[model samples]
Target chain A: MQKSTQAGFWKKNQRALAPWFFMAPGIIMFLVYVIYPIFQSIGISFYEWDGLGPKTYVGLQNYRDLLDDDSFYTSLKNNVIWLVLYLLAIPAGLAVALFLNQTVAGIRLYKSLFFFPFVISQVVVGLIFTWFYAPGFGILPHVINFFTGTPTAILADDKYATYGVIAAGLWPQTAYCMILYLTGLNNISPDQVEAARMDNAKGWSMLWHIIIPQLRPATFIALVVTVIGALRSFDLISVMTVGGPFGSTRVLSYFMYEQSLSEYGTAMGYGAAIAVVLFAIMLVFISLFIVRMLSQERNA
Target chain B: MFPKPIAQSGPWTQRAYKTLLPIALVLWLLPLIGIAITSIRPGSDLASGNYFGMPSGFAGWENYSSVFKNSNIGYYILNSFRVTIPTVIGAVGLSCLTGYALAVYKFKGNLAVFFMFVAGNFVPFQILAIPVRDLTLHMGLYNTMTGLVLFHIAFQTGFCTLFMRNFMKALPFALIESARVEGVSEFRIFWHIILPLVRPAMAALAVLIFTFIWNDYFWATVMAQSVDVRPVTAGMNELKGQYKVAWELISAAAIVAALPPVAMFFLMQKHFIAGLTLGATKG
Candidate 1:
């Protein structure tokens, strides 16, 4: 009788309760690690905590300090630069994908080889680029020397350090965008292309009008990934410059790590404040993306 | 079909296209090629300033062996596997449920919850660094493999759920409805029907997550500090410091650090691309 009662209860409430039961583990884990930490980090930004001992609430002092801090502005400016320059990967990737869209002998191997850099870790990419810019022995410096008569170490120069890092970053990012566009190109309708061709559409006009319109989904995704990749530009910076040569290479993400975790200082609150600013920037993009996804969800 | 096919173009255009292909590839991969060549070059060649020349001799064996012998890289790699494998299994397993719930069920706040995961997945790691570290410390799992694994599994669920939900959404809903009409329990349906069908997605998520966790450097530095818990990416930094200007050894070590993910990509190329380009072709 008890078993039948239990079964009856489950049978009746299953539709409402089953979803929660299914989601319990993921929801709990996401809350503990990801969702809760976001708010906690924001809360931490207001306190003067060195990661240990009692936390003293300092109100807006951390943000106030950030306002006065030159490093904050520098990091913020470099972050803007990163955001602007990183978008180049989308067009560059599209170009490569277009060029390699042809089918010929061994083209499959060529496509994979072209997409190779994205597979390696940023740490390895940083090291490789460091060697490439290694003043005397690096290939890039040698090439620059041939042209400019001086082997300028790009990473060492304040004006070029962030650009140098961004270039290394672009290598993999472009590969990523290329693959996206390649896949997008593959899914394009042959019928429409043939129709356009019959109407005497070819070359640049054809591409701008027909090909690009169909690549909207691919372009949107590429833009989103590239933007986020720019904001999360910590790994490459951490490995390559560590915000060095007068801290010219410091993005907000790297600056946060420097303030909170590095051996130089352990100002947890300050780091949290920086992170909040970065999060605020990311939230703008995230909101835009979520808004679009919500509309799609409704349509679906 | 766009841009006019090479076969339909003039012979000159065809030859030009063929020649440009290899040259473009070489130039694009020049940095990687340099590292690969440097990894095998003898120390004498680098010291003698033959940086870009043919190697004096094949010293790949010596350099790679010495990296293993003289460093904690081997141990770090083992640690990476311990952390990454469990993360792949845990994240994928958990998301299979979360994704199914979101995809198969129609309920209030469903889209809200789905968007939450999507948003959370894109947030910068710095935002979560302090509290996650604090949480791990509070649980006495800080600097331990368990701490890192738990955090990765949780964090990865966001992306996995997004992927899995979208994938499950595309499946015909009729299967679930018919099974439900027969009074098949939700759990049994998920296990016996949904699980079997989602194997391809599971494989895709597995390889993608494996590569992601393996190549993760920031979290490796943040959560796990001890020698026993440090992964290969963090260990590569230490190797860099120790081998300053020893280009050959550093090159070999970087290659070693990157080998797993590179191998994963090559082995599961199709699935990796599918996972990455999940939303590229459609909304």
Candidate 2:
């Protein structure tokens, strides 16, 4: 009688239980690979070890060492520069989107062709830009030479290397932003646009007072993705300069990898410390994003 | 429509606009065009400083073939497919269930769990790299395609869950409610009723994930080390080190490596754009 009653109980609550069962593999895998690793990295940051040796509890030495580290500051500064310059993509993209938002023949093809850069791998983007910035044969150098009578190897110079890499990154990022804005523009109500036109709104005033307000959601998403992409800027730095020209191009992501994994960089603990700092910074923005998304969810 | 279509302009202005379109496109694609020409140019042209000029002879076949023959590019391409395909399938399949659960049921932690996935998806990868690599090494899966695929599936789940949950929430609840009223089980409702309805969302996510995994360079470098398992992104980097001055061959290989994601984007442009601009259109 007990067994039959238990089976009956199982049959009744099975719907609620089944979701947990279905969610098991994904959640478990995510916890192990993504969630658990976050704490593990935090723990590792407190230790002193060259990945192969016994880990010694160094208690905050890594943090203390980071205080005096010059490269860390340079990387942080370059990251700030990257963040600031990368934002230009949003406005530039919106401009392009507005330019292309018309009923011209084959405009769809034109827009897609413009967006071609974003779809290609960053490795290729890096290569293309590296080629473009190559000294004599590169187009940029020739243009500079034509103006100044001297060719410049931008990537080989410490002062300009980071900016050069950032430019390469902006090419694709701008395309991505443009596509987002184009889609956002597509859904704008034409009746509202006509209503505004009847009110004598035109050109920049129309965009600012009428159109910009409507594009708030797209702007928010653009800002979120752009910030994340800027912080995670590693592949371009790796391919274009390898954080070179005396490490002027180093960003936090590349620097972390260098310290943790490279032959000359066996300081695993120090690397983890850097990683933790980056995570903390990202967490601040992520928290804001979550709060905003939650408010949206509540409203919905 | 937002800019007021150019056709609404006077005829002279419209004629000028028509003439300017091709010119603007050429300027926009100039760098890519240069690269394409350079890729097909003979080695003699680059050596002789004839970069922008027409190639004296087209060596496209030779350069492209040499990239395949002289390097492990074939193996690298295969590795990319192996990593990308499984990741898309795993992440999408898992999210379909998680999404369905969150959308159909009113659990206590639903919003919190949903937000966690959304937040996790946007975090920097470095935060997860060290420990993920360590864990992979501990599991004896490091430097293996299986290790990379597993991590990708897990990490990608965060993004996939956000997308899937949003999509599933947009679905009508009446269908599920009616099915339940007819005495259908939740599992059967998901499998028989909800799954088919979300096929477009699944396709969108699949193509997006495929492009993302295929283009991933950082994790591929972090997890896999051996040429036997390295994907094209890392492989191309290695080839760059070896063939430093072989611009023709290097450019050919780079273009070849970039083709899959580019092709996927063009083929699924509508769904891809829809997925990317999900929240952008709505007020």
Best-fitting candidate, measured by TM-score?
1
Please list the residue runs of candidate 1 whose C-alpha ends up more than 4 Å from where it truly belongs after superposition.
none
What overall lDDT, based on C-alpha atoms, would model 2 receive against the true structure? 0.89
Off by over 4 Å in 2: A1-3
Estimate, for each residue in B1-283, the C-alpha lDDT of model 2 and write its tens digit: 5898898899998889778777877877777777888889999999999988879998999999999999999999999999999999999999998888877788678787777678778777887887887788999999999999999999899898888888898899899889989988778899999999999999999989999999999998988899888999989999999899788888999989999998999899988988888889873
Could you tell me which 10 consecutive residues in candidate 1 chain A have the lowest summed lDDT? A258-267
The 10-residue segment with the lowest total lDDT in model 2 chain A: A14-23
Model 2, TM vs. native: 0.98
Tens-digit lDDT track for model 1 on A1-300? 999999899889999999999999999999999999999999999999988879999999999999999999999999999999999999999999999999889999999999989999999999999999889889999999999998999999999999999999999999999999999999899999999989999899889999999999999999999999999999889889989889999999999999997766579999999999999999999999888888988887
lDDT of 1 by residue, B1-283 (tens): 7667788889999999999999999999899999999999999998898999889899999999999999899999999899999999999999999999999999998988888899999999999999999899999999999999999999999999999999999989999999999999999999999999999899999999998899899999998878999999999998999999999999999998899988998999899999899888987
Colliding pairs, model 2: none
**Which candidate number maximizes DockQ?**
1
Model 2, docking class: medium
lDDT of 1 at B184: 94
The best candidate by lDDT is 1
Candidate 1 deviation (Cα RMSD):
0.9
- Compute DockQ for each candidate against the true complex: 0.86, 0.77
